[model samples]
Target: MSIRHGLLALLERGPMYGYQLRAAFEESTGSTWPLNIGQVYTTLGRLERDGLVRALPGGEGGQRPYAISDAGRADLGRWFTTPIGRADPPRDELSIKLTLAMSTPGVDVARVLRTQRKATMAALRRFTRLKQERAADDDLPRRLALDAMIFRAEAEVRWLDHCEAHLGRPG
Candidate 1:
């Protein structure tokens, strides 16, 4: 996830300090991705330097809030419209590990798949439960985030099954 764009998106809501941005981010995403306070301040500094956000005068609590600039609005708008490309996909560590295991002598790929399938299924169950609990709440962002995670976990399990089946077939 692009922390820069995320901060800008939150700032689009209104002026917010580093702490406020961190809290709002977690709340909006259902705490799925927690941000470090230091990371938040660092990103804010970069955003301010880039002129995507401008620092506001210290509030009553002396917190230095930031507001999105016009450029920031344009950047955020572009981010929203841009479809995430598959040209440079993120590396799947699990896939890498499985591939290495298959090539390494004495390494049991089947065992690895079984272990990962168990863990992924456990995560899927937890996500499903969370989704059910939050289903009635009027929280679209959180629901969307949870749904994405749940679906990804389900897909991973399916991929693992496919890998096992492929291994069993005569070469």
Candidate 2:
């Protein structure tokens, strides 16, 4: 989820002021993804300098709107067609936490897993509540998004259970 590229996609829809882009991105993603307006404007400026967008002068007190250029459309098309191969190193946060836990001689690994299990279960419950709230509001899209989050949280909880189960097994 590159906010820079996501902003480009929004501009491709039509010309938009920076604030509009920020709001649309947040709403479309159910407010799960956060964006900084300053960062958006900085990226928009770079896009303009790169010939991917053109900034039109503001009207009176209104903000200046930016539109995607022909070059920008082409760049977006290339991005769509290209596969995003993994170039950056992977980050396994849970593995790192577990490694530290193993190194701490007095650390209780089971206690750590139990704490994580409780947190993950709480997350799942929170997401479920969010989904129910969205359902009551009759917002299908947001409910769906919350459902995905709930499912992911439950999956992690299950994985924690498996890890705990194997903690004392023969190597």
Candidate 3:
């Protein structure tokens, strides 16, 4: 998720402590992607080490404040503008497991697909409910994130249906 870059973008707004940064991040996107406080601090430390962020001297807040340097701004800009290509070697754990199942003898493919369909429907329902609940927020970023979740869930549901319909049927 390039959380380090996300933190840099937040810091660009102004100097902020880790807790404030965490809250700001969660609020801005409604945290479709969650982050632990420890992870935020870890990223902050890395940014500081990388000369992207500098700690305020003698600050005594529960979470220390950091300001973005010019280098940090440049890095944030570069990160945002960079295009992300598909990973050279895709790392899909689900695809790997399904491949093994398909190869193994005496495995009921329909049963496997039905089980996955159940799970996917549950997830789809969850996302749908969340989207309905957020319908009134009217915040662009949060709305966009919710919309993304809904779209992905719907896509998974369609794929599950397709898999179930085609299982064990050779073309």
Name the top TM-score candidate.
1
Q: Could you tell me how far off, in angstroms, the CA of residue 28 lies in candidate 2 after the best superposition?
A: 0.5
- Relative to the true structure, candidate 1 reaches a TM of 0.94
Which stretches of model 2 miss by more than 4 angstroms? 59-62, 81-90, 136-141
Q: lDDT tens string, model 1, 1-171?
A: 999999999999999988999999999899989999998999999989999999988575777989999999999999999999999989999999999998999998899999999999999999999999998989998999999999999999999989999998887
Model 3 scores worst on lDDT over the 10 consecutive residues at: 89-98
Supply the TM-score for candidate 2: 0.79
Q: Write the per-residue lDDT of candidate 3 for residues 1-171, one digit (tens) a residue.
A: 788998999999999988888999898877778778899999999999999999987667555789999999999999888888776865766567667888899988777777887887787788778778888877888888877887876887787687667765886
Off by over 4 Å in 1: 59-62
Q: Enumerate residue pairs that collide in model 2.
A: none
Which digits, one per residue and each the tens of the lDDT, describe model 2 over residues 59-87? 44678899999999999888888888789
The better candidate by TM-score, 1 or 3, is: 1
Q: Residue 64 of candidate 3: its Cα lDDT? A: 72
Using all chains and alpha carbons, the TM-scores for the candidates as numbered come to 0.94, 0.79, 0.87
- Winner by lDDT between candidate 2 and candidate 1: 1
